[model samples]
Target: MSTITTIGFDADDTLWQNEQFFRQTEKHFATLLAEHAGGHDIEARLLEAERRNLAHYGFGIKGFTLSMIETALELSGGKVPPNVIREILDVGREMLSHPVETLPHVRETLEELAGAYRLVLITKGDLFDQERKLAQSGLGELFDAVEIVSDKTAATYQRIFTCHGDGPGRSMMVGNSLKSDVVPAIQAGGWGVYVPHDLTWVLEHADEPTAAPRFRRLEHLGELSALIERLGREG
Candidate 1:
């Protein structure tokens, strides 16, 4: 196997605290509409709304905000007050303005690997929002390049790996989501290292790779440097 020369990282949930904010916002939203629907019912409807709106609004806080509003309107039988709508918007604004909290060992791991490989950030979300987060994240300087894409797929990984590194086998993708980060990169012939997060968005959930040689799982980002070193040596 070709030696892994390029490293791609997923931003949200992987490098920083992301899903927790969404969960908190969801909790706040549920409380706002508790009269219209129970917590479970409201959460289910909001998730469905988010899924349906993905193609239309794409991904990001803006889309999530709209989905929450839509879910509120639907559950309230179009009777949701303007003040409630304003509160929902406020939730989104707060999320956008929230500080980017780096995950444990994220900065240190990136720093350790930065000089040895071409580090790339492969994240899917709103461009402006991603950019803002990157700016706020002190770890931005570690990434050689940043790609804020609309989505993650095998084709996308193939193109990115091919451009930045020798090819798929020579590149590795590290992330928290199996759906968006690991599976697609592995399918594209790149090695994928899964670093599980405490919380994951339901939409980004996917089954684990059963028996892939190039797929490895770790408990956290702190263990990533060792995994990469082992992979490099084994190759």
Candidate 2:
């Protein structure tokens, strides 16, 4: 039998279309600020603001919107018109209300694994926004527990796994981010399954843990069930 008794999933690009919306909004934001700054400069400054404000705002559309506003103000020397800020707020509102689009194979994979193991949805973001996405995704019923956290770290995974399953040693965390989803879970002694998403946020990028014995990478979630079975057989 597989040593893994619990499976944790990341919500944002892992289960549904998320970053793409942010990307689209970013383009619109750039267009809105074209008179004030170049696209490349705006993008770089926005990323810097995001990195700097993470501790204060955490993560989600609200934080992202704040970062965009801050970026606009800085790039435009605090002279960006009020209408531009309004447009930015509208963009953020649109993102918050955007329909949740589940990625291919997500539903089927969750359905196949739900009965056999403890499944947890572990994602860090604005609680209201995360909850909204979860409710809209319609995948909430399949998970044994849901965690909307401020961040993902080794201690976070250890605590979650211990609360919801056998523990980190018997758990697996699967997601698109090698930084937030895979690395910390591995550090907590669980299997870290990296599922690459094409539109991953630049901030979430991390070097792959190719040397780790428990590290695994998948093209997509469709391959997850077979990989779990294979791991079980190996054990």
Candidate 3:
């Protein structure tokens, strides 16, 4: 039998439609600053602001909105009108209120695996916003436990897997971001399955670990069940 006892999943773009909304909002943001800056320049400055503010604001819609406002103020020489800021806030609110659309094969795949292994929803972001998304997803009950963390690191996976299952050695993490989900989970001595999403955020990008024995990649979640079965048989 396979030694793996727990299966962890990343939320955001992994399980549902997330980054697309952010992308859409970014386009709108650029439009709002059309007179002040070009789209490429605005995008670059916004990314810079986001990177700088991550330590203070953390993640999710609130942080993103703050970064957008900061970029607008800076790009517009501190003359960005109040109405623009108000529109930014409105877009942020729209993101928070947007319906959770689970990705293809997510539900059925989770259903297939849930009966055979412990499932944990491990994701990082604004606590309230993450909670809202999870509740809206209708996939909450599928998870044996839910961890909405400030970040994902090797230590984070080690602690979570140990607390929720046998240990990291016997756990697997599936997600879209190699930076936050795959690399750290593998470094924690667990299997890291990469499921690439077309709309993954730029900051979440990382080089793939193709030679790692515990690393795996899938074209989509629909392939996960067969991969797990193959692993089980390999043992």
Tens digits of per-residue lDDT for model 3 on 162-192? 9999999999999999999999999999999
Cα-lDDT of candidate 3: 0.94
TM-score versus the correct structure, for each prediction: 0.98, 0.98, 0.98
lDDT agreement of model 2 with the native = 0.95
Clashes of each: 0, 0, 0
- Model 1: residues >4 Å from true position, as ranges? none
Residue-by-residue lDDT tens digits, candidate 2, 134-212: 9999999999999999999999999999999999999999999999999999999999999999999998999999999
Model 2, 113: alpha-carbon shift in Å?
0.4
What lDDT would each prediction earn against the true structure? 0.92, 0.95, 0.94
Ten contiguous residues with the weakest lDDT in model 1: 226-235
Q: How accurate is candidate 1 locally (lDDT)?
A: 0.92
Clashing residue pairs in candidate 1 are none
Residue 227, model 1: Cα distance from true site in angstroms: 1.2
Model 3 stretches with alpha carbons more than 4 Å out:
none
* Candidate 2 deviant stretches above 4 angstroms: none
TM-score of 3: 0.98
The alpha-carbon root-mean-square deviation between model 2 and the true structure, to one decimal in Å, is: 1.0
